[model samples]
Target: MMSDAYNNLAIEFCGIKSPNPFWLASAPPTDKAYNVIRAFEAGWGGVVWKTLGEDPPAVNVSSRYSAIYGKNREVIGFNNIELITDRSLEQNLREITAVKEAWPDRAIVVSLMLPCEEHYWADILPKVEATGADGIELNFGCPHGMPERGMGAAVGQVPDYVRMVTAWCKQHSKLPVIVKLTPNITDIRHPARAAHQGGADAVSLINTINSITSIDLDRMVALPTVGSSSTHGGYCGTAVKPIALNMVAEIARDPETRGLPISGIGGIGNWRDAAEFIVLGAGCVQVCTAAMLHGFRIVEEMKDGLSRWMDAQGYRTIEDFRGKAVPNTTDWKYLDMNYKVIAQINQQDCIGCGRCYVACEDTSHQAIARLVDEASGKRTYQVIQEECVGCNLCEITCPVQNCITMMPQQTGKPYMNWTQDPRNPRAEKVPTAA
Candidate 1:
């Protein structure tokens, strides 16, 4: 009952095949079988059930969510003080098994977070494996609530712990293990390398950041205030996309972890976000905040949009464009220093708003010139090519689209990097390109 146009969206990540690359993340959205079943009905390819722990599960606070809103009151970033599943382990396992059996075509990845003991992992792995779920994503990334108990980021922030627990899971279970990484660490590469060393099947990231969205000035406390106080919660949504992309790229290009499958997470709200993650080396992508904001039906847009894009790009399969951008993602030191670009103003499209002039003159390079016609009392703004650094600040601040553009200059100078520049104190002794 599926169209051939979307056939290319299918992907097999770490041996778990799905109808498409979109999966609901292990969050409140996938907390129950009912929610997950609805998501599947809405065309989501898979779901990583909400993170589970041993019975007598995590008791969450009443006011668990806080959000930072955009000008239009849309949630730019979401924060949650809620802990893992508060339901009994037995109940969660039963639902997972039933869901898997019912929707055999959809991928069901169970997310787990237990104590960092080998015996604990040894005890739980088989119980989850018996459910016939497609995979297990180790929840080592929760930044709040659990970390204080030495379970989430407390374990993920340490490389040895990541490797040891991952090893234990591999030893105890036949299912693929995906180590969900915490972005709270200093360098994301360490834990990714640790997962690889411990023989993980794949890795997913970046878990919510530790943050406080805002404070109630009236109460004089952080948001989602419980009584007189509030604690920092996990921060997610569109605000974290840039950070997620960089971390995904880091693991993708690292020699120690190259070729290791990645299930990208963080701020992936639309098909474009999913495509960006794939191009940077994620085999699949997970979504949470977007679903919470827009409901399960959002996946329909994601699926249709991604399929259309793939068709237009002539990419027959996800693998065709996966990691295609990794080679081009490089260090700034390797960038061409001789490349020159300047801002150009299209007077015809300019509304004479003078926003570009004010922005550049006040804060940036003062690269824009404002001219007034005395006879007509009309204002015009132009880019001073000599002063423009091609920072694009003017263009970004401009209200009218296409009014300002950054035009590259053919400087005739050969490609030169910072390492080869004479201005560098420790310049490499390499011949310049002719």
Candidate 2:
């Protein structure tokens, strides 16, 4: 149960006010007007309408989806070869206008993609603007089919194309423009800088990573085979959350793109995931694969949980904690070398599971030992402090939470890191680690 006497989750993104910061990403979840309205009813604050293109919508293949599973057979990764919205451009525009009129308070940003030519982008900007939608997000992240046609990831992969198309959209449309970037590129900052230079109001990241989830060993075909053949697709879901987080942090911490409003999009499935993005500098968070898997009702849990969590943390609003974690996220060269910690086993809490012992002895450092209690003839495991590196593997392997913990060791030495160490040839050495 949550009390209303707490923080305000409302946020202003790109000059548009959303009741909360949760928006449905441009995917299956926001493909139609009915879906968008239903999501809003379910407590989502906004939605990026499914990506649209010029007339003659692209045709999608049958069996265009696949899944990657975990040990328990839970779907952790999702793959899709589906192209942009296949509905007629006019029909989508009509629905967008109706949905926007019905829910004027909610943010309705349309996601778009088209040919590389400025004329192609120039042509659709006014049509989208006429719908009175809040803004536009260029969908340059779809990895598969469309890229071959010089659109989607094709435009996204090249910084020049991203900048050019973004400029075209800004020039032609009066609406705020957001450039949704792809993760396939070697450096995400390149495209982000390009978008900012092109006059985008904000940027949303981590559209999707290029991937082939699986291959059918028996059939010798890729996953979601469309009549004995398949192509690479965009991967999403919990499996991609780590990648998404790092990319978001990279952009948030980069001096070149810092202060640019970011709408985080990736494997965000719950309040905690959304909080992580916000703390890492997302003005708002968008969800897709999770909605596709569980349905729109999940937004209720997200809203309630985020509001309650905010209350507990003493945060009065989203801005209080947004980008709070950015300073702590830095390069390896800046990490402390003098600080040290060692693993400790809590004998009382230990269930005598030797999982940690086996893990440390075999795969990691030989820090844990299996011992027998002479009096009771009980088997137990203990950590050898001298050899323990505080890698946290023992703690991770221990099934009982808090059974194995890392205790800090006071080195009584001034802080130093690899960047300033005397042993390094390039660095002008500071005091070496004692």
Candidate 3:
């Protein structure tokens, strides 16, 4: 199914061939037609046009965002109370038609959301189809301000609603429909199965989450304060990558929706994040915060980096090793109990800055060694073989090239912790009365 001579850069998403798996997600930056067209020209595989709904129903406040900054005061997390496309329906369709005509190969998935009514969906499906875009992504995942209006997450939270809306779209539109699920629900699979049952060709998740990072203690307002007040807004960016990955894996591994095509989103910042999703069964990757944070041009690095890494790994096409790693993942109880590890320090490369020591001693287990010169009475730092927890913190904090390493632990006695290893004589599940 793969050819070594062929470039492995391109991947398929929702039955659409994307030049790269990376796509700009539906967010403020990719909302406009001008922005979407530029992104397609910038080597992006696709763009999900901002969520659009039935006419005259959507409104937005100008001052709707609040941001959380890092120590350097850069925005690390964003909060937005904005609603779906405030732009006119005619304008979006006209733009979509133009962009698709220009870039026929690039994916042009229009993200849609309307009232739960079937008539609303039936009324507009033909209109959207007239644009000749690749597909439609149901935007039932937006979490905050729009929920109260009985849209976004309001539709996503109920499985019946998800199934109902997806069926309507499928019935009305010949184009592939992707049901984007909300992360607010406890069980993601419920909505995922509902989408599948409703005849959705694919599903993408997860949309932004509800969050309020901090408060203005003195001013008595939340961090992303809009005129001295704020509410829970959809959070995106680098912070939510792990959450997105796990949820993607869950759906991929679940028997109910295991074969369902998934378009991974939430916090994909770079190529590695994109690759991880591919390995875990995502057909394509979506970007929002990363593109918004950097710029549309960042897709250049994403494409190049993925191509290089794939080449190095001997992958000639996107499907060569797709979902290859999923089989390797197993339940925690099935993990190898015999493996061992230790911290290995490269003295020549060691800067001896002591940041690693501070991190390990004050916070983590004091598994590091203090080397002493008996004659001169001077001391140096190293790793303690017996005490180290094998966390790799030293390797992470090490300033030098190869200062610290986590050497694998060969099979030996089982780790005798209260919870971890089965061979540990004392290990047992917490007791419950029969």
Candidate 4:
């Protein structure tokens, strides 16, 4: 449990307040009242209820999940072919109203999906508002089943459609509107900008990416194979964290969308992941795959860890550090051309595993040298600094912690970028920053 003295996790995102930053995303983990109640009991700050559509509801396929595993058989990536809530609208609304009434302090933002029509938005917005939920997240990012029906990613991929739909929802409902953006698009900024222009209060992202996890060789069909045929599903889990972070940074730093509230959702499994998103400008974060994999109790660790970290960092609130990393995130062309780092092996810590040597010699630059003792036949590895590109491959491949480290070289040259480098043909095109 987070101590009351340092309980700084509370956040108010686009007018929706949550006791903590962790919220269950609108996936299977938040499908119904039963699951949502358990999540709240487990200490989740909130939940975006599984996407609700018009009745008669959307039906999902059985055997809807497939996964890519790490060497230890851990689920590194997850795929799902499931669609929106299959339950009727009336039932979902009743339960939503009950749960919100029961736990008024917690956020209960409803995730909604409807056809690209003004009448549909106008009809359903009032019904959802009557539930007394905190807000509504437009389901524009489901990349799998819903797209085939001209919903989900189909509407999300088009900026015009996103703006129009968002405008319709805002016009129809008084509740705060959050447009969920799809990751399948070439540039995420376009849809995000459109959502902002259409009067969205915030945006949650990186809804599942399109993917096919694996194929059953014998059946010649994708895993989670159904009746001998299978289709691509949305990919998620820890493997997508890097991609998610990059996209979040893109939107956070974009001049047009700057200061737009973001609810980051992609491969967020722990406190560190959530903290990274927060520093990169996410006001709050949503979780799905992590809860599905480890159950709802994981929020306990997430909350505790984040609280402890914040205390150590002298941050009293999430806002203190939010968007701190956005300015540091920039294009590679702006990187210092003269800056350099080289690998240095700590002989005392080195176990002589030679993993670093083998990795650098074979795959990366041949920067590590293997030395053999004449009498004892003992082996030692040393870094050849001249050849080291400071790519950190050797440091990454080493099994022993702190065995290989990258040390920055004291290059006397002033900060210079590719734009000012004399070697570049277009060096004169842009003025160098003073």
Residues 157-177 of candidate 2: C-alpha lDDT, one tens digit per residue: 899888988999889998999
Clashes per candidate, residues 3 or more apart or on different chains: 0, 0, 3, 0
Off by over 4 Å in 3: 1-7, 374-378, 397-402, 412-434
Off by over 4 Å in 4: 1-6, 429-434
3 against 4, candidate with superior lDDT: 4
Pairs that collide, model 3: 66-224, 340-409, 341-409
- TM-score, ranked from best to worst: 1, 4, 2, 3
Instruction: List residue ranges in candidate 2 displaced over 4 A.
Output: 1-7, 431-434
Provide the overall lDDT of each model, using Cα atoms, as 2-decimal numbers: 0.94, 0.90, 0.83, 0.93
Instruction: State which candidate has the highest TM-score.
Output: 1
Question: Residue-wise lDDT of candidate 1 within 226-249, one digit each (tens)?
Answer: 989999999999999999999999
**By TM-score, is 1 or 2 better?**
1
Given candidate 3, what's the lDDT at residue 431? Answer: 53
Candidate number that wins on TM-score, 1 or 4: 1
The residue-level lDDT of candidate 4 at 35 comes to 99
**All models, RMSD in angstroms:** 1.4, 2.6, 4.7, 1.8
**TM, every model:** 0.98, 0.96, 0.89, 0.97
Regions of model 1 farther than 4 Å from truth: 1-5, 432-434
